[model samples]
Target: MKKLYIDYDLFLRPAEKDQPHCSYVLRPGNDGPACLREEISFLFACRRCEDYPCVNSCPNGALKREAGLIKRSGFLCISCKTCSIACPFGIILPELLPYLAGRCDRCIGRLKSGEVPLCVSSCKNGAFRYVEEDDLKGCPDIYPMGDSIIVKVFNWLGSYGIKK
Candidate 1:
């Protein structure tokens, strides 16, 4: 399976309002035509950082840090805009607003095209890679946070008896 890799900086740019919203549809071999498995959700600002101050600064408990991922609880997000102000890397900005709905998207489409996400591809250091989660185990030093936020979010939701 292919995975999406994100370019954090590109995600911060404002979307042109006139741009058409494209959907990512998938067609399984058994399934008859293409079915809309999911939509291309808004790209969000990056949350990865060695010193993640924004995670703690969010008052609504919306920000979360994980290995290789920073997941936000959009349903719990009050959008008070505290996280945006607290990020030190300038990864979060006022114009890089969050989409009110949808799952955390890590730029899966770009990876399938033999390219990294825009931000990572543009990086001078070649910092990010879109690899299988299992493949990351051997390279622990890379993506040091490794999907911790994803697990945490699921656990948090489970604590409240939420199925998802």
Candidate 2:
């Protein structure tokens, strides 16, 4: 049984995100840019804003800044998505927010039945897959987020072959 991994390089393009996939169980939705960009999202680390706009925007106070990084309380999150918009960096995406507590079975029933996980099967862009654990060796864009999840983020501006 291979672990599941997700590889996508389309976060910087919001217009293309208008596709039909709307389930977190399928992919880590558009949370903005990854690494190697001026105005992109961050998964390896947070920006650590001085006056965290995202924290203040949370009506439920589910978000708080600790150790310079913003952390969310899974129990307190109401799924309002207000924080997402409030995020000055736009890294607070829906997929990063849990619908409920921070607990996901990862579609155990589906995997047990010898089928790929929901995300791997329904991913229209073909970003998800099952692979041996050793395959986790990632590239500059590839980030190995534990729990059998792999993230391959794209440097949006670099995609254009633009010179900095």
**Backbone clash tally (model 2):** 1
lDDT of 2 by residue, 5-106 (tens): 655544333345433232234335422121122112433434566788888999998987765556678679898989889877667766566554433445
List CA RMSD, all candidates: 12.5, 7.6
Q: For model 1, what is the error of residue 57's alpha carbon versus the real structure, in angstroms, after optimal superposition?
A: 0.7
Model 2 whole-model lDDT (C-alpha atoms): 0.56
lDDT of 1 at 68: 40
TM-scores, one per candidate: 0.39, 0.59
The local lDDT score (0 to 100) that residue 53 gets in candidate 1 is: 78
Best by TM-score: 2
Summarize candidate 1's per-residue lDDT along 1-164 as a digit string, tens digits. 33333222232232543211222224122211000111111112242456777778888787676554455675787767787788775555543344443332343575457654443343343223344556445442222222421110112223445332
| Error of model 2, residue 8, in angstroms | 3.8
